[model samples]
Target: MTQPSREAIQTLVTQCLQEILNQRGTELSAPLTADTPMFGTGGLLDSIGIVTMIVDVEQTIAAEFNATVSLADDRAMSQRNSPYRSISALTDYILGQLSEGA
Candidate 1:
């Protein structure tokens, strides 16, 4: 199976962020970009917000990509650099998971 392109994954991730922002009735201080921080103290999301985003991302992947993945599993937690750290990292991680699932 072919891996999804980075642009495709980034688009999906951005859509997820927008959906979450809309639900929370909040706006980002800056626009979402590859360098945008996602989790942790200075990031756009709090703990609950991160959880919500992860769930939304996972569901989006399943619905859109026809693949089931667990984005917050033990493997993700064990990573030296978290997959959840930035938009770029998360997009790469999702692509990796999709490749693995394929």
Candidate 2:
């Protein structure tokens, strides 16, 4: 099977984030587009919100791609730039993982 492209990754990220936010009872003021930031610094989500998002992303990846991913961990916490910061960043992070055979 062929792997998805970068745009597909971004789309999935937005879908997962939006779905998870809705489940958390948080309606985003704006629709989650490619540029929508997951972290509160740029968008509507806070730290705890990102944590919930991480869990959702992990679940979606596992179910959809049969890939187990760790979205929230020491690497995330200690990084100068967080993977959940924005849609683009998150997409890059996920694609990197997919490339690494994660």
In Å, residue 16's CA in model 1 sits off its true spot by 0.5
TM-score of 2: 0.80
Pick the TM-score winner: 1
- Local distance difference test, per candidate? 0.86, 0.76
Best by lDDT: 1
lDDT for model 1, on a 0 to 1 scale? Answer: 0.86
Give the C-alpha miss distance for residue 63 in model 1, angstroms. Answer: 0.7
Model 1, 19-59: lDDT tens digits are 88789888777778898888864788888988998999999
Model 1 alpha-carbon drift over 4 Å, by segment: none
lDDT of 2 by residue, 1-102 (tens): 356688777777888777767777987677777777778576667777777778877788788777866767688777798777788888888887777773
TM-scores for all candidates?
0.90, 0.80
RMSD of candidate 2 to the true fold? Answer: 2.1
